[model samples]
Target: MRKNLRVAAYAICVRDGHILLARSPADDGTPEWVLPGGGMEHGEHPHDTVVREVEEETGYRIEVTALLGVDSSRRTFPGRLLRRPADHHGVRLLYEGRIIGGDLRNEVNGSTDMAAWQDLDALAGLRRIRLVDAGLRLWRERPAEGRVQR
Candidate 1:
């Protein structure tokens, strides 16, 4: 099996006691909630990627405060249905950011449905998409060092 790795960054944007989140444009149109960000561009810094992605997704320019943590997940795609082996993995760096400016709006034709501030308490009851809890916990703890264990 051949191994393929990808790197991306996500922003944990917060303001006024609420957190900023995006509803991803899933294949089935069942958008799932996820942090605002995406894959890194070649030769681009991770910090820059997070900032750029957040702005692109949420229409809010932000300032990255610190690296929250790193997360990894693996999946398999059927080789018979494709050209190569199925094993795929991702290394994602999560960062904490504060909005600097820009009115909040969804990017045109982006992979996100909408952007909004969900109260911290609402998180407990709302059926959030994957990575919401993880991002919130990291923001709450705001660890000085080390990565958050999944």
Candidate 2:
């Protein structure tokens, strides 16, 4: 199997019983909601990456308040003919954030199509990315190690 690794940062911004979310563009023809974040750029700090990614995906300037936790996940993907399957590992940093400024707007032609504040109580009915649940768990549980076990 081919191996791949990725490091990303995400934010949990909840206010007024709503959670901030970005609607991911349908890669498999099924749109899913996710936290406002993405993979880090080369030479960038994870903190800076979260700020940049949140702004890009949600059109909101955020102040990172606390380190929620880190989450690690692995998956296998089918490869093309004559190639081995790909094994991917993702390490994600989840942070608590407060919206400080900027207006809400959809990211144009980005990984996510739209951003919105969703009712927390209604989340169970929504189609969402796994990261959403992971981030929320970190926010709620706040384990001492600051890492969620897969």
Candidate 3:
């Protein structure tokens, strides 16, 4: 049995009444918005991963201020796409970060299709960029010290 485990980090960058997010290219290249962060590389901690990913994706230097929550998601891969059965899964660590430096510049050599701030309330009206709602909820209501209730 081949089991794959991945650790990813995300930041809920909030200032004033807006939240910074990057539109992902994975959702059929349609640019779905999401928090500014990505997967942890080898030998890197989740905190450092979020800082690096946020800068890479949003072009803004941020520091992880607090740990919001942790979550796990899994999907079974059908044999049609691969030679054998496998699980596409992730363990996500959500963090609250504060922008310390750097200006908003959409890196031409980046993974995101777009990076911008969206009204916190207006998020519900738009077709969110995935995990944004969950991250925000966790940040707002700091649940226990384990995995989020949801």
Candidate 4:
């Protein structure tokens, strides 16, 4: 089996009862909505990573106001192409962000195809990655230990 670890940062930006989200293609090639974030670049601070990712995916410059919490998940699956079992662990730092500048525009030549603000109440039917719900939970729960229970 192969083991992998991934660390990323995500922003929970909300205003007027809407949340900022980016649309990306999921593993099965379905369009899935997720928090505006991605894997960190080596030598990049997590704060800087979130700022850069939000701007790249949503075209909105933001300042990370606070670290809301951390969400970690682990899963094992059979590799489709490698013919091996794999373990993947993901850690995401969820931050509260405020949009300071820039315009809303679709990302070009990026992992996410577009960005949009969705109604918080309307999320139930939308196809989304688990990060979306996890980030939102952290934002709302604001646990003292900076972690949310499954």
How many clashing residue pairs, candidate 4?
0
Task: Return the TM-score for each candidate structure.
Answer: 0.87, 0.94, 0.89, 0.96
46: Cα error in model 2, Å: 0.5
Cα deviation at 28, candidate 1, in Å, is 3.7
What lDDT would each prediction earn against the true structure?
Answer: 0.83, 0.93, 0.84, 0.93
Give the local distance difference test score of model 4: 0.93
Question: Clashes in each model (backbone N, CA, C under 3 Å)?
Answer: 0, 0, 1, 0
Give the clashing residue pairs of candidate 3, or none: 33-129
Let me know the TM-score candidate 2 reaches against the reference structure: 0.94
How do the residues 6-81 of candidate 3 rate in per-residue lDDT, one tens digit apiece?
8899999999999998887753566678788888999999999999998988889998899988878887765555
Q: What ranking of all candidate models by TM-score puts the best one first?
A: 4, 2, 3, 1
Q: Candidate 1 deviates by what RMSD?
A: 2.0
| Candidate 1 C-alpha error for residue 42, in Å | 0.9
The residue pairs in collision within model 2 are: none
Q: lDDT by residue for model 2 over 1-150, one digit each (tens)?
A: 899999999999999999999998566778889999999999999999999999999899999999999989999989878988999999999999999999999999889899999999999999998889889989989999997765
Query: Which predicted model would earn the best TM-score?
Result: 4
Model 1: per-residue Cα lDDT over 19-112, one tens digit each: 9988785646776778898999999999999999998999999999988887778988666665776688988888889899999997788878
